[model samples]
Target: MDLENQLKNLFPDHVSEKVSEKKDSEEKGIWLQDDPIICKYEKRKGKPITILEGYTGATEDFKKLAKELKQKLSVGGSFKDDKIIIQGDYRDKIMQILKDKGFAVKRVGG
Candidate 1:
């Protein structure tokens, strides 16, 4: 006779719809695109940095990807102007990670 009982009493004729578990399990909340994401290395202020771009998705999704990459690589980074700027050179690792996550990655420059 808790919340469930109270709800049933309030709406005896109401039918509760069951949520689809398969759909929820399938969606990662990120959009997958055909074009490959560009991963490039650069030097700003004489410090090496990795930049990821060309993601044709929502900003929030890109931010989430940025956060995940930083955590996985255990490095500092930021999301700016539709791009992810990660500290240090981690092109190979980043590309492998993206590929494993069903993303196509293109490495640019040395």
Candidate 2:
């Protein structure tokens, strides 16, 4: 028997709550701020990198945003010093994404 069935057999009177799937209309827990997030491009070690910073929200929220951005862009990245450092120069794409998510974004450096 599966674990669920065994658990049910062990506690017939116990009730289990159904897991809820995230709905599109649900708000992401990240805090919104009036200040525009800064998106910039830089060459570090002769490789192009995109950096996003200036978020005033909780650190965990920023980390989650970084992870989401990396997944959507299909690239490697890191979150450090309150900045999201992406592997490529994706300023336009990243700005669009932040705008779609209701965050103001400012692009810096060509």
Candidate 3:
């Protein structure tokens, strides 16, 4: 039997139409908050740090993205609380990377 017919027979009650509709909504766009990106230098226990905030993204994808960014910038970084923290000041660099990745990004505080 054809794949479509076989699937229909397997789930007689549930159909593919409902699944398609839900998939359409999810493909619209990556939902991003209207908040400015914030970058700042911080000191933690006498160690210098750089923090980036105002980001909303899925944890797994966020980590993957962070990994790529760190590699690109040739710096060390980590993801925590839905935020990306890269060593040193890399606001412009990170902004450019996100833009290149087709993300609607805006730089906020210095």
Candidate 4:
């Protein structure tokens, strides 16, 4: 099954459904929350970086996600402050990843 289908199946609830729709609507952004989950990208020292913040995600799950993203992007990254930071300009990549993971993402800045 496709990623969207998988997410739907994994989270078959109203909240998940609403989030899924929102993610679909917002294609170039990060999904963030104060204490829940936040995903965004930033430019540091002329380098593009993706930061996944406010993630109260489990250790194992966070590690798994980080590993997957690093592998996919072929870059160095880490999980800190309950967030994921990937090296390079990964706005597009991170956006897609979060969308697949069922998070509503919004891109801020050029």
Task: State which candidate, 1 or 4, has the greater lDDT.
Answer: 1
Q: Per-candidate TM vs. native?
A: 0.76, 0.78, 0.56, 0.56
Stretches of candidate 1 off by over 4 Å are: 1-27
Give the clashing residue pairs of candidate 3, or none.
none
lDDT of each residue in 1-110, candidate 3, tens digit only: 89889988888887566356743454344444555556666667776566766666556666776777799889998988878888877777777866665666665554
lDDT against the true structure, per candidate, is: 0.91, 0.91, 0.69, 0.69
Q: Pick the candidate with the highest lDDT.
A: 1
For model 2, the superposed segments whose C-alpha errors exceed 4 Å read: 1-20, 23-26
Q: Which ten residues in a row have the lowest lDDT in candidate 4?
A: 25-34
In order of listing, the candidates' clash counts read 0, 0, 0, 9
Model 3: per-residue Cα lDDT at residue 101: 56
State the lDDT of candidate 1 residue by residue for 1-110, as single tens digits: 89877998999998878777863453478898999999999999999999999999889889988998999899999999999999999999999989987899999996
lDDT of 1 at 36: 100
Greater TM-score among 2 and 4 belongs to 2
Ranking by TM-score: 2, 1, 3, 4
Q: Which has the higher TM-score value, candidate number 1 or candidate number 4?
A: 1
